[model samples]
Target chain A: MWTRIRDFDRMIQAMDLFNSRLGGVFENYQRPRLSAGTWGVTESGPRTNMYDTGENLEIRVEVPGIKKEDLSVKLQGNYLEIRGTRKAENPEGYTAHRVERGETSFTRSFTLPSEVDAGKVEASLKDGILTLILGKAEPAKPKQIVIS
Target chain B: MSERQDVTVREEALSERNRQIPTVAPLVDIVENENEILLFADMPGVDKNNISINIDNGRLALSGVREVKPVGAVIWEEFADVEYRRTFSVPQSIDVAKVNAELKEGVLLLHLPKAESAKPRQIEIKVG
Candidate 1:
C-alpha cells in the first residue's frame, strides 16, 4: 500500500509539471497578432492538383468580401498574375461579440504549359469563387488518324 | 457504487447527445498532380449561380454567404448560421492564364496547372 501511494504521488507531480510547462508555452504564443505569411491564407507552394488535366485547365481562387471591379489579371510570358484588394469593415464602439473579418490585398500566379493557348484566357467570378478557363493550343489537342 | 454508476450514465448520455450536433462546415478535398491541382469544396445549400471567386495582389480569396431566412414561424431548427471564408497564396509557377473552375452538385472544383518546367520528362535508353 505504501509503494502504491508513492507511485500515485510521483505520477501526480509529473502531470503537474507537464501541465505548467504546456501552459507557459501556450501563453507565450501571442493571440490576435497579425500573421501575414501562411497563417492568414493557404500557402502558395505546389498544390496537389497541379497537373491533373491535359487539354483544359481550371483554376479557382478564394477571395472573400472583394468586389468584382477591384480584381485585375495580367499575363506575363507563361505566368498569369492576379491582383486585388479587399477592405474590411470595422464596427467599433459597441461591445464586439465575435469578429471574423479578414480584409486585405492578395495576389497569386500560375505558370501555364507550353501547349496552352495564352491568347484566349477567360475568367469569371460568381459569389466568392473565381474561375479561370484556359484552352489548350492545337498541338496539345489529340490527333486523329484516317483509316483506309 | 450506485451513485457513481448513475453519474457515469448521465455523462455518457450527455456526450452522446453532443455527438449528434452537426458541424457547420463541410469537407474540402485538395488534389495535386504533376500538371495541375484540383480543389473541391462542399457547400451545401449554397447556390452555384450566386457564387464568386477572386484572385488579386498575391492572394486568392474564397467567401460564401449562407442565408436561411426564417420560414413561417420556426417549425424545426438544426442549422447554425455561418459565413465561409478561406484564402490562399498563389505561387509564381502556375500558368494562371489557363486555369478553370466549375461548380456542380453543391461542390466547387478548381483546377490549377503547373508551368512546363515544373513537370517531369522521361529519358530514353541508348543501345550500344
Candidate 2:
C-alpha cells in the first residue's frame, strides 16, 4: 500500500512537472515540435545532482548514443563549454519499423566562480558517462603559519 | 498521423495484462563531492553508441533513443512509446571540461569536478 501510494505520488508529480512550463526553456527553444520530416534532435542536459562543494564543484550529465571521442570540453577563464553531436544510423537497409530516437546536436556552457583555479582539470569517459576532476590551485589551498 | 500511431501503440501496451514497459527513461541521480560529482540513471535499452550530453550557457541537455523494431505483424506492442527528452540548468561552479560519462549494465554514470581553485582545502593546525 505504501509503495502504491508512493507510485501514485510520483505519477502526480510527473504529470505536474510535464504540464508546468516554469523551467522548460529548453523545450521551448531547443526542442522542435514533433511531426513528419521534422528532423528533430533528442534532448540531453543535466539529469540530476547539479551541486557544488566548498572545495570543488561537481556536475553530471546524461548522453546516451554519443561516443567519448566525439565529445570535447574547454575552459576559458571562468567559463566552461561542452560540445558534441550525435548522428543518425543508416536507415536505408531496414524499414526503421519504429524510430524512437531524436537526431539533435547540442552545445552548453557554464560560468565558473572566482574561486575556480581554471587549471589542473582532468576528465575521463567510461561506459558512455563522462567524469571530470579539477584539482585546487596552490594559492587556494589552506595554509598555516606561526604567530609571532 | 505518426503521433496518432504512437498513441495507438501506448493504448495497446495499456491493454496488456503485464505491461511494465517505460515510456520515459528512469530518473537520474547526481551526487556531488569535493572533487567530483556522480550521476546514475537507469536506461534499460540504451547503449553507448546512442547517448549524448551537452552543457552550454548554463543549460545542460541529455537525450537518447531505444529503437524497438516490430517483428512480423505486430501482434502486440510494449515499450518504445516516444523518443526520450530531458535537460537541466547546471550550476556555475562546475569545470565542464573535466567531465566524463560511462554506461554499464544499463546505467549511465557521469562525473564532473570543480576547477582547481574551486576545490576546498584543509587548513593545518599549529600548536606552538
Candidate 3:
C-alpha cells in the first residue's frame, strides 16, 4: 500500500512538473527550463552529491558521455560552477534507428556550505564521474579545543 | 516500414530488490548499418565488472549497479546507489555468438551482427 501511494505521489509530481513546463512554453521557449538539482527531471543537468569532511568538501557529479576536454570547473571563494557539453555521437555511414541522447550543454553552479581555499581545490574525472575536493579555509577547518 | 526490425526494449516490472535499490532505465541510442546494429547506453558510475549483458533465445538483458559512498557527513545528495536494468527483444537473425560489447567512460557499446544467412546476397544468372 505504501509503495502504491508512493507511486501515485510520484505520478502527481511528474504531472505537476509537466504542467508547469507546458504552462509557459511560449514565453520560456528561448530560455531553457533551468534546474540545478535532480529532484524531478532526467534530461537536465547531471545529478550531484556534496559531503563535508573535517578539512575538505567533496563533490561528485555524474557526467556520462562527457570527455575531459569538454568539461570545465570554476571556483571562487564559496561559489563553484560546472560547465559541460555532451556532443551527439552519430557514426558515419550508419542510419539512426533510435536517438535519445542529444547534444546538451549545461551550466550548474552552487553556493557551498562553507568557504574553500581556491588554491588547493582538486578535480578529477574518472569513468565519466567528476569529483571535486575543496579544501576548507583556515577558519572553517574543524579544530579540537584543549580541555581546562 | 518495419522491414529491418532490429530490437525492442521493454521495462521490467519492479520487485523486492528493485524497491530497495531504485531501478532506472538508462538512456540508449541505437544505430545500424548493413553489417550490424550498434547500441550505446549511458550508465555513469557503474563499473565494468558490475555490469552484465546476456543474450539468450533472441532476448538481450543488461544490468548494472552503481554505489555512491560519501566521505564523512552528507550535506545534500541528488543521486544515490541504484541499479540500471533493461531488456530487449532481439531478432533471431542476429548472430548471438559474434556479439561483442565494450564499456568506456560509463557508456556501454554493444554490437549485434546479423547471421550469414540473413545478410543480403546477389545472384548471377547465365544466359543459355
* Per-model TM against the reference: 0.38, 0.39, 0.77
List the candidates ranked by lDDT, beginning with the highest: 3, 2, 1
Best by DockQ: 3
Query: What is the DockQ for all candidates, taken in turn?
Result: 0.02, 0.02, 0.29
- By DockQ thresholds, what CAPRI class is model 1? incorrect
lDDT of 3 at A77: 75
State the displacement of the C-alpha of residue A22, model 1, in Å, after optimal TM-score superposition.
22
State the lDDT of candidate 1 residue by residue for B1-128, as single tens digits: 36543234322222112111112233355556667766655553356554566777657666554443332223222222334456777676677776788765345667778789777789899997
Write model 2 residue lDDT over A1-148, tens digit each, in one string.
3333444655655664653333333233443332212222235432312334435554443444556766788887667787766565323332322234434477767765434567767676543445454454556544677799
Q: For candidate 2, give the DockQ.
A: 0.02
Model 2 CAPRI rating:
incorrect
Tens digit of per-residue lDDT, candidate 2, span B101-128: 8776445666767778778888899998
DockQ of 1: 0.02
Estimate the overall C-alpha local distance difference test score of candidate 1.
Answer: 0.51
For candidate 2 chain B, the 10 contiguous residues with the lowest summed lDDT are B10-19
TM-score of chain B of each: 0.64, 0.69, 0.81
Report the poorest 10 consecutive residues by lDDT, candidate 2 chain A.
Answer: A33-42
What's the best-to-worst order under TM-score? 3, 2, 1
